[model samples]
Target: TLSLFYCMVGVVLVTGGSGLVGNGIREALGKHETGEEYDWVFLSSSDCDLRDKQAAVELFERMQPKFVIHCAASVGGLFKNMKNKLTMYQDNMDINRNVLAACHHMKVQKLVSVLTTCIFPDSIEYPFESSQLHDGAPHPSNEGYAYAKRMLEVESRLYREQFGHNFVCAVPSNIYGKYDNFHLEDGHVVPCLIYQAYLAKKSGQTLKVLGSGAPLRQFVYSIDVGLLLIWMLFNYNDEEPLILTSNEEISIGDLAQLIVNAWGGNIEIQTFILPTAFNLKYNAVRFQQS
Candidate 1:
């Protein structure tokens, strides 16, 4: 009877649950057809300071989660990452280390950690392959953050190799959707443009864009990323990192226009500085849920 009870029940823990990607995963899980069977726990930074190892261990021990979606990390926009490289590096390293260690110690059935395209080498070719992850150095603009995430992949593989843990990594492209950070200087492109457009429309001013708007990027919808994460949690069980990205590539200019058109405002392109080399392209991900 006790074994039957264990088999029938499972706890799913989602860290950084208040953020955009975390919220997306939680919402997708809610809409799943068989979602009623598992227990899901969403933990934001406020729930427990995961940067603290003892606190992370205490939380894991108390929850005894069989599944963990490790989404917690120190994230910011291009400028923020560039300016606060050290902080981003240290904070994310602490969070990832504590969470992954806890997951291994607790013997969680599976742990899917989220990563970003920014971790790829700055000089890597387009249509990025998973095999080229650690081939070269990442862009200098955000190397601190990139290397921190890069280590997650390394740590995941090492953990699995040594302890035989089911620790996997998911690499997603630029994600945009609801609950995103809208800070003018520290937010991602999409949310920041949206906010700028909103302000421009309200004040009857032309929206200003920072760069030449030539760099290309693939922005996956947060909800779509969430669904994919859920699928990966159950369907994917390997050490190789899964790249989750769309094939549609949009220039910064077009993306800004889209935002302006949505808000019914005109845009002004200002070349404050030369655009950095941050273009990203990916082969279409093969998985989908019908």
Candidate 2:
């Protein structure tokens, strides 16, 4: 059913190409040594807003990429998410609904959508498997965002089951690496901690993190997750949801230390005790994927 003459890879349309995961996938795919270079088109928040039905349709009609990789969503750390529930829910929900609807309209050959590990609930089994996704309710702090991602999973599943489509969904663990959001208000734990600490070190001031440093989180490097995405898209039919992660869990305190080490052992990182239950759950994810 396949031919050796098929050398040209499909044109790739990456939503949120400016974001960490999208950028990571691009680098992984375009690596000079081994990863085959493919034609790719990047769209940021401005180029084509998925929230607009007309714009999404117009963009889909123009390039008509045979493959679409959706890495776009409104996501951030616990503080921002807890404060802005409606924004997170509405923004992420709109993006997925409009984009997936456009893909169905354009009939793109295949799609790869990324979801967060936060959607997998608090009582996650150790070494969390893809099968345990539906085991428990999501963490309350991020329940809104998690609900949107779960809806994404369901929509993609329906497409595959009813229409025989290739809408692949990947649920990756907490991801971090280069190009991660480093903004003081917008960045996640790793970038925020590293950059803020580096600044504090340079300015000779005290640095503080939000929690008591007890929250359990599992982190995967962005590129590793990207590689897993492309691998599943190319090599498999994607019968089940694939998780781009390792079962390694780390405490918020220890994670801070890792960044301090990765920051080349130059900065001091400190955490202040917060009254949040999220912090008391450190190492909770250790048994989640084990």
Candidate 3:
């Protein structure tokens, strides 16, 4: 049996601590008032390049954490994914592989790895489920990144079955909030739109939005995801991946309008329809807790 003293003094390490989700987790930890119970360490890329196996193992040894939340990965927008498939696949695979190996080597009590809804196959049915992950191939544009993420799930399950490691995965929908990447060409949807809207409003020009703005996406607040992750750390242990998302789905056009409304609703949005092949629609299911 685990001793109460050990549990109370446990350490929790969070990788990719400088990114959007990491900021959300930090906010959630402060909101819950549980800082006194466990020592929390948030690691950014500056601390160590997780792609290096030796560096990863050394970091884990130094932290000696009881719980780990693996949020580090190579992420970018659609065009970037298409242009740099090899880099995305190689970098993410390395980070995930090394992290899992280190966690198992140290005998960590539990681990939760964050995943994206984009990893789901493009031709699958609506309302994605954990069981249908490998049903088909992902969209070609982001397949490299998707497959790498899929492998993370595979590694987690294998580790559980072969070594009995308490490793699990969390699949979240389009997550947006403070500290998000706002790069116009390389950032995700929401942040990119926000940035464009800001520039358009300031310059008094119409905002040029790519695509038909018809793709449906489900977005969850980062802080909400953070809260759920904390709950999962203590109460969730199953190997099946948990889906973290919201019920409401919004279109990109309507989403842009909302952002404009927030900024005084003075800028007009112009839709720039891309080629038929480039327009992709993502119809995600509502959030379901496992």
Candidate 4:
């Protein structure tokens, strides 16, 4: 009876439960159709500070979660990471390391870590096969963020290779949708443009986009990211990285227009900058959820 009790499926702990990815996954998992049983504690920013190792350990003990979806991150746009290099790198690294350590010791049924495609080098090889991860270097703007995430990839491999711990890793593409952050300084490209476009409409002015409009990017909706996270939890067991991209190629200029259109406006973009080699390698990930 005691052994069966330990094996019963129940609730799960989702760190960064407030983030776009975590929130999506929690909602999807929590909404399993009738008779499916699994409670979820959606921790807000107030529940605990994951940055503290003691707090992480304490949370793990209290929850005794069979599985942990570690989506908590000090993430942001390229500019923020580039500007606050030290803090960006150190904080993300520390939070991830502490959380994983706690998960390992607690014997979490499994752990799924989501990383960004930005972690790939500026000169990405076409098709962006999972193997190109360690090839060359990540874009400088995202280098710090990438470096911090690289640890999760490394640890997952080490844990599986040496200790046979269960873990899954994902490298998702540009994500955007409802509940996305729109903070002027820290938001990602889509949200930044969304906010900008809306504000420009209110102010009756054209929005200014930085860098060249030519660098291509892929945009995956929030729900898509959630589905992939859940899929990894159930279908994938390897430590190898998996990518999630819509592969809908669009220029920054076009993306800006889409945002403007999404905001119900036609705006002029008046900015000129040399096009850097930050090209996107079209990864085709479709939107999931029926």
Cα deviation at 264, candidate 1, in Å, is 1.8
Candidates by TM-score, descending order: 1, 3, 4, 2
Per residue, candidate 2 scores C-alpha lDDT tens digits across 48-158 of 888888888888777667788899888887778788878888989999988898889988888898988777767654545666767888878878888899889989889
TM of each candidate vs. truth: 0.94, 0.85, 0.91, 0.90
Tens-digit lDDT track for model 1 on 74-168? 89888898899999999999999999989988899899999988889888777778889998999988888999999999999999999999899
Model 3 vs. true fold: TM: 0.91
Clashes of 1: 0
RMSD of 3: 3.7
| lDDT (Cα atoms) of all candidates against the true structure | 0.86, 0.75, 0.85, 0.76
- The local lDDT score (0 to 100) that residue 207 gets in candidate 3 is 91
For model 2, the stretches where C-alpha displacement exceeds 4 angstroms are 1-9, 32-37, 262-268, 275-290
lDDT-best of 2 and 4: 4
Clashing pairs in 1: none
Best by lDDT: 1
Q: 36, model 2: CA deviation in Å?
A: 3.9
